[model samples]
Target: MRRARVGIDVGGTFTDFVLSNGADGSLTYFKEPSVPSDPSLAVERGMAALLDRARLEPGDVELVVHGTTLGLNAIIQRRGAAMALVVSRGNRDVLEIARCRMPSSYDFSAPKEEPLVPRDLVFEIGARSAFDGTILARPPVEEIAELAETLKSRGVAAVAVMLLNAYVDPTLETEVADALASRLPGVLVSRSSQVWPEIREYERALVAGLNAYIHPLLERYYATLTRRMGELGVAAPLYITASNGGALSVDSARARPIDTVLSGPASGVVAAARIALLTGRQEIITFDMGGTSSDFAVSKGGEPEYTTRTDVGEFPLILPVVNVSSIGAGGGSIVRVDKHGVLKVGPESAGADPGPASYRRGGTEAAITDCYVAAGIIDPDAFLGGRMKLDRAAASGALERVAQRLGMTGEDRAAQAAEAALSVTTAKMATELFKGLAQRGLDPRGFALIPFGGAGPTHANLLAEEARLAAIIVPPGPGTFCALGAIMADVKRDYVRTVRRRLSDDGAPQALAATIAGLEREATDWVGSEGAIVEATQLSAEADMRYAGQAYELHVAIPAALGKTMAAREVGELFHQAHERLYGFRDVDSAIEVVTLRVRVVGRVPPIAIPELDKTATAVEPKGRRRVFHRGQWLDVPVFLRDRLVQGQGFAGPALVEQEDTTTWIIPGWHARVDAVGNLHVSRG
Candidate 1:
């Protein structure tokens, strides 16, 4: 009767589950086709299958960590509940006039980003606050009641109240929001200051609006998920993964669903970061290729980079999140010929409903996965442990349409087209990876590619070669790594406040101390609530600082001891050091200023160590051989079963290693060997 800890990640095409038993340290993986109409249904199904496969009772589950892209999809697809924005009288167009700049300054023809709240739905109240935390005016009780009536008449499902300058002091904003919520009854009302408390009016408003937009949808989802788990005879605590590469309690997530918008991608990056720290591979790139898209995160010195200025679609999100850049297309990305007969892969996906042509689920379009099958990268019959056999003929037929459109005729036309589509996909991925690294001045050759997800390992070698990288690491159970990451994530939350003042200012140090103290106090209480299930906690603090008169600021790590009243001179030095690392040089003589303060608190979760495989006495035998198209010719490549290989067993190039979840291709002129952790490492010959 071993209690199991489970992690489930719901993706566009599949819901993945990873089960870990602490008693024997055994881990099992499972995948189920996703149900787009109800993602939770897929999760429940997958969890049931995983538990049964592991021979564990539902009652034996201790904790369940889950991640999903529902919130992000809602935002991107603009399908969230209708929400109204309540702003100060003069700022009704805050979202419309965002930043006063186009994404492309020179392209006047560029389309403007769609506003989260329609202008007609925006309501302006008489509440007002000065920039210095002084309440200049308050909304009249009669006026508020009228506004509530208007919102009710409009049938807005949620309301976001953002009074001007309320970030400086949330007292009035909280009162107004509370009053409105009471009047609205069932409609959710969120205050900008309560959601983020950041200085920028527009960003803070977006945060509140996003929370309100997703609140009801996430609430219903959690209610169903909870009922399903309860009916399964499991009483385990549930945690939802957050965008900051951590897990928060389900209650916290329901209240702030916006924080979990990037949950699916963040979990995989967190897992890679943990592995990097443990294996001492400090400088590694995590490449996660799932069904809809491929994303990669750079981890250096055992930590993934964090950003506060990332974008979700065209909308800017001013919250700290693990920076993951979308680099490549995914398996279900459609492959087609444009009007000019130019072959193209996708930014659009087939998703789970029809999936790829090979899925035989009413899909008519050929996708990247179909290319993998036509080109011999993935075995059609062996996919998903043979539980769901792929339609190889159907895949070829779909691809043949594209080939005929290209004016080609022959048995090799389909293979040629598939290879060409794959090349286009890989080339695009390589280019994005190079450019993303260029932003940080990182060299691809200096880093190893650690690829996970169903398609990452399958395409890693090609990407590495195209990007001119030296090596690749394919971890075991790559397809389910996101779930593993969800399980590995610690309980966490982030806090930020604006303190726009120069260190050289007469009273800046005391103000800094007060602001830092206030933020730390809030962080302590917040993390405490989120980490109620954990035993210990970890905390880190950073200040966004810049040289006086600089347009942008850099985040500088602050010592915990400096929380009370850090010496202004020492703080300046830390800023200089951070600047030197980021830029090629730092000006020691420049006056420094601190713009914002950020605090991250993590509740430490018990780590699950990777159990080593038994040492092998001889090289593992190949399961069979297959004709794989490579460099314009078909070659018979050795195919090996991944489970047969133990630690220290070595293999050569021109090989295909097949597992239940994914396939790893070892290209010519390279060699691969299994490490102690059962990871397949491929490097140049």
Candidate 2:
């Protein structure tokens, strides 16, 4: 009786589940149509089907790790619980005054993101602390009592307390929060220091408030999932993927749901990294294309970059997370020419229900898929393995409108317009990819692009061409890569403490050392309680620092062995080295200031075995040629069956490799080879 681990991912269009039995190393995948209005319903239904598909009793399953976009949806849709903020008397407008930057500098009509908390819901307390952690002002007891009464009167379900300089010492703010929570039973309360003990007041408060806003919702959701799982007879502790490429127990996730907002993308990055390691690739880039959007990430030395300032919806979060980019225009993106007669792809998606015009679900506009059809790539009847039929005439009819608008005629014009639109979208994606990599001093040419999702393999060549990538690795199961990633993440958490000071023996070394020690102890305690192997605890430490007078800061790694014993100059030199590597210049003469110290605790999950491909399988060519679209002309293209392709076998364009779940196209002049591990390496001639 081998234990089984399940990974569930809830996407915009589909809910996917992957179950891996540790004993036999068997993998099973299942998909269910997603319900946008209520995602948990889809999860429940999908889990039941997945369990049944595996033909295993619920009690045989040992762990079920899951990832969802519920918190992200709440922030994007502004549908979280009605929440209020409590700030220092003079900082009641913190949310509105966020960094004071508009989303778009070119569009004058662009409005600012609606603040999560309205003006009336923002109450203030007369409590303040200086940057040096000295209490400057404290509100009277009666005033706090009245403020609590007022918040309750306003029907606020959650509250965030952010007194000025509370990051320096959260005692006053925590006392105030305790009083409010005591008075208003069942009301969620979040303190800025507890959430993000960094210096930026507004950003910290937003993180805490966002956490509070989604707390109740996640609590209820997790409770329901637990009950449903119990009903199915599984009592194994549930785990949820976090944005940092790790897993959290259901209890930890329910406490800080914001950490999982970008978990879906993180999972894909992790999955790609694992595959890269197994396949002997040291550097890789992952492209994940789903129904609504495409995401990409770069990994070096088998580790994905982590960031603490990722944006959730329009709000910035202060939690550390795996760095991944949303760079792909998904399969559902509507293609059209703007009023200027210039063709554009998306930031807008048609979603699953009304997907592309070819789906025959009443869509009228042309999309990327229509262009693929016009160019003779995707088969009209073989989509989803012919389980779903796409209307080629409808697709061509819609694309003709685009061709006419773009001043073209015949298949040449239609195919050219479609190719050009794809080129434009690919260029946009490549540019974003460049920026994300540039920030880390990474070069695209050094990495292989691993494209997944529905459109990942289909569009990988075009994107790889635009990004100038050296190689592309089409994974064994590219479509469900993220779900696979969720199944692979280890259980982990992060801890932080604020310790602002200049680095010197006389400056705040003792204080900084104490702060770092305290954070490590806290991290150790939390990780210890998770029941992971006690002796195998892995702890990583880092600090946030900036040159004095600079408005921004950079996070630099601090090896855990140093712990509190690290000297002041050693810390300062770490920032200088990191800054020089990133910016190509270091401010050697500038004084350095430490803003925060962070520790990451990771408890390794059980190891996963990589599935070996059957190299003894035979290879075959296409049954026949089809008039497929490419380069503005129809060519008789040879298609190969991916399942039949064997290791060390090679194929060249103009060729189409077909699989049950996806299709890979090798554009003219390019070649593809089946590697030893069964991955398809498509690259330039």
Instruction: Give per-residue CA lDDT, model 2, range 1-685, as digits (tens).
Output: 5389888888887787788888778777766767887777888887887789788877788888898887777888788888899999889899999988878989988988888899989998888888878988878889889988998899888898888888888888888888888888889988887877777888888888998998888888888878878887777778889989988888888777877888988998998998888778899988888877888777888898788877877788878888777743887888898999988898787777787788788888888877777777788777766766788888878877888998887557767777777787788888888998887778888889998876789889988887889999998667667888888888788888777777753748777777778887898788777754223678788888898888888888887655566677788788889998878899888888887888898887776665666778766667667777666567888988776788888988878877655678788888999876668999899
List the candidate 1 regions with Cα displacement exceeding 4 Å.
584-590, 616-618
Model 1: how far residue 2 lies from native, Å: 6.0
**TM-scores, in order shown?**
0.98, 0.93
Please give the distance, in angstroms, between residue 436's alpha carbon in candidate 2 and its true position after superposition: 3.0
Angstrom error of the Cα, residue 319, model 2: value is 2.0
Residue-level lDDT of model 1, residues 1-685, one tens digit each, is 5368999998888889999898788889998988989888888888889989999999889899999998888888988998999998989999999889886889989988788899999889888888888998888999989988999999989999999988878888888899899899899998888788887888888999999998988889999999998988778999999999999999989888888999899899888887766666878998999999999889888788889889887788999999989843999999999999999999878887798999999999999999999989899999988877998888899999989988888898888888888999999998899999999888899898889988999999999989988688888889999999999999989988877888989989888888888777887788777644677877778899999889888988899888678689889888888888878688977789888888888888888767778764466689999999888889899999988888888888899999989999888988999887888989999
Question: lDDT of each prediction vs. the true structure?
Answer: 0.88, 0.82
Candidate 2 TM-score versus the reference: 0.93
> In lDDT terms, which candidate is top?
1
lDDT of 2: 0.82
Q: State the local distance difference test value for candidate 1.
A: 0.88
